[model samples]
Target: MGEACERPGSTEDCVDDAVCATDASETGDPADPVWETYTCRAVCVDESDCPEGQECRGVTGAFATRACQPLR
Candidate 1:
């Protein structure tokens, strides 16, 4: 198994109140490792802090956005 596969439980091990993200590494010409890491909700202070393709929507909390929309 690869490095990523070895840590399948890493995400689940995080505290329930905190968010989790996955850090993946890819092999290529130069063996580009750890290309990027997708964050969950742990490091986010606001919706705008989310990645470009994702959005932070609140239901019973603050009246933030309602859903994640496409980035134009």
Candidate 2:
């Protein structure tokens, strides 16, 4: 895959068809800036598609598109 995405908006630079996905659990809290980080993940068909410690999940808004993510 390409380099890990450092920003929070787009995944155009991610390799291996990966997209930039934000951690849902990390968001919604104005007090936490750590949640602003984005991860480069390939779209997943199931949990198996995710890395060992993560799982495939779908969010509701702009992040709604399914991708590999940490378990919530």
Candidate 3:
């Protein structure tokens, strides 16, 4: 299988594929400062590993995607 096809259990296990730059603001202006981007891999191992107000949602290649939602 190809290297990209391999999956990691967690973000710590992910190898950076690219160093993308993201604007610091929502305006999407190029003049804005750039932020480093990490490969979209599992950022957390479990729900408890997520932030206090966020939940982990599974992504295609990532173990989970951290999303914030109101408590039910």
Question: Clashes in model 3: which pairs?
Answer: none
RMSD of each: 10.8, 4.4, 10.1
Q: Judged by lDDT, which candidate is best?
A: 2
Q: What overall lDDT goes with each candidate model? A: 0.36, 0.62, 0.34
Residue pairs in candidate 2 whose N, alpha carbon or C atoms collide under 3 angstroms: none
Q: In TM-score terms, which candidate is top?
A: 2
Native-referenced Cα lDDT, model 3: 0.34
Candidate order (lDDT): 2, 1, 3
Error of 2 at 70 (Å): 1.3
**Residue-level lDDT tens digits of model 2 in 9-72:** 4657577657776654444664554455566777777888878987877632336567777666
* lDDT: worst 10-residue window of model 1: 1-10
By the lDDT metric, which is better: model 2 or model 3? 2
TM-score of 3: 0.28
lDDT by residue (tens digit), candidate 1, 1-71: 11221222233434443333333344444444453443333334456865687554432222332322223
**Of candidates 3 and 1, the better by lDDT:** 1
TM-score of 2: 0.58
Backbone clashes for every candidate come to 0, 0, 0
